[model samples]
Target: MRVITVEEHFHHPEVGPRVMDLSGPPPIDLDADFSTFWRNFTPDRELAEQLAGGRLEHMDAAGINIQVLSHGAMTPGSLDHPDATGLCRQVNDWLAEQISQYPTRFRGFATVPLYDPKAAADEMRRCIDELGFVGTLTQGTFAGLFLDDPRFEPVLAAAEELNSPLYVHPGIPPASVLRAYYSGNWPASVEFLLSSPAFGWHAEAGIHILRLILSGALDRHPGLKLLSGHWGEMVAGWLDRLDEAIGWGHYLDRPVSDYYRTQVWITPSGMYSHNQLKFFLAEVGADRIIHSEDFPYVVRTNVADFLLNADIADHEREAIAHRNAEALLRISPL
Candidate 1:
């Protein structure tokens, strides 16, 4: 069966100039210039070499159609704030252009100006109507507000109305968090992986998602689709604990697992372990899972091999490899 790798990722070099303005004196190293670190950290030549060596091709051999999520404006400084509609327009144009280049091999997700809900909503409409993007991708938190903030209601509402999925990926750390890690001489490479799972995934992603659920966002917008990265960011493992917490008359008013199973979907990007995949499938039906390589950050060849060879039933393997994403993205079967 042909598979659609719905969670592949790519970064645009122009994202640096388009998202940031470096005219002013470089602020602090950890806080202000972290964007520079991320941009410089991943060398394009290395990525090109991998792709050229048939690494990505191997995934194609496994019947996977790569769906690339074009890198968008990273927030920090004067570059491209979420409230900047003009910047969003430019980014949307870039994403559309990227998709056009590989119509069969790629599809795109839009980045909207999240600082302003009206602007975000407007840009989302344009991305869907004009650019034909599958959905919009956002950071776990924007500026300082979590996804559940009332300010973002319009953006969420628009996505639901348009039937577009919302892909939430990890971004830079908050100022306070960055300070602690930097002062401790912590390597970002290490800190990012650890913090994303330990802190952001649980505190920010989980809490915000729960807020959306309890607030009746999903109940109101039942068609809303949410895609999370890093194998659901440990959400699968937390289900039983979450149920225990909720059952014990904890903070959440409803069963946490209900929201997880019904309203959200997760991608197997950056996670390739058989046990992890199996756990996610058992906890949140295989249909809620999608395939992703977190490419450019992860070695594509290794991921393709892992997914293809994982010890799962043929049907479940096919579902995670491509079927779930196709259904979620509304992409026709190959």
Candidate 2:
């Protein structure tokens, strides 16, 4: 099957620059050998040989178009890594270049420095207006402030104005939390997966998103779209609990599920459980679920197979593999 891979990933050769104070403790050794780190962190050769090379053979093998997000390149250490304005320009320029290279098979999501909302908004505009990017991808939090912070209103406003979505992927936690996680000799490999969007769901990310909803951001700008990867960090399972809390008059005036179904979408990246997928679809609806492969770092061959072989009807499969992402990105069918 020809699949429109909306959530494919690519790493920049240089990802060490964009690191912020929020990524938790520096991975064990700040001075670790760069060459070895790059080899492990990047997906260039592997991805090229595997999916890009058409290595996985099946009669109905799924072919994917890529949408490159950031690797670790924009980390605080990268060359063009700017304070704010410079970062935006660098990312916008990079996205424009990607579009030029893969005009048809590739699309890009802008990586902006969320630490500064004004800078983020400007970069998003440049990426969308000039570079033709569908949306922006950002680490879960900037500095210590999560996305729900009022400071991010400008960025969200800009996205709403442009009718573009904001893709929120996981990043390391703040320095304090990093210390706690690291003190246990917890491997980042295991910890990052276990902690991410799920942790964010309970901690700052969920709070901020809830606040955003209650603050009327979605209501004011109905066109605004948001994408959460890692199956919304397990948000599907907890919606009812949150909804119940809200119904019992906790923080917001209305039910939290109302905002979720109306304004938010989730990508099935690491989530492959069919029952879970069905559950999410039942709760959030299929139109809001898009296909994602955490990619490179986590090879997506299995996910591709799972979606292709699933027992769902043709329309459901099509909706998840391509249609939903197209709608969110506003990309016309090819």
TM-score of each: 0.83, 0.81
- lDDT of candidate 2 over 26-129, digit per residue (tens): 44333335445546655565453223343233112445654445433334312223455564565457546755865766677777666567877887898888
Q: Put down candidate 1 lDDT per residue, 1-334, tens digits, no spaces.
A: 5556655555444545545553233223445556666676554644432233353465565455665564532532123354356766666686578567667777777777776778788888888888888888876566556667788889889999999888877665565665564334555544554555445444566566666776777777778888877777666678888788767866554687887888788887766788888878788988888888766556555555677788888888788777787778877777
Where model 1 places Cα greater than 4 Å from the true spot, the runs are 22-40, 45-63, 72-83, 180-203, 250-253
Candidate 1: lDDT of 37? 69
Give the C-alpha miss distance for residue 72 in model 2, angstroms: 5.0
TM-score of 1: 0.83
Candidate 2 residues lying further than 4 Å off, grouped into runs, are 14-62, 66-82, 180-182, 185-208, 214-216
lDDT (CA) per prediction = 0.67, 0.63
In model 2, the Cα lDDT at residue 276 comes to: 78
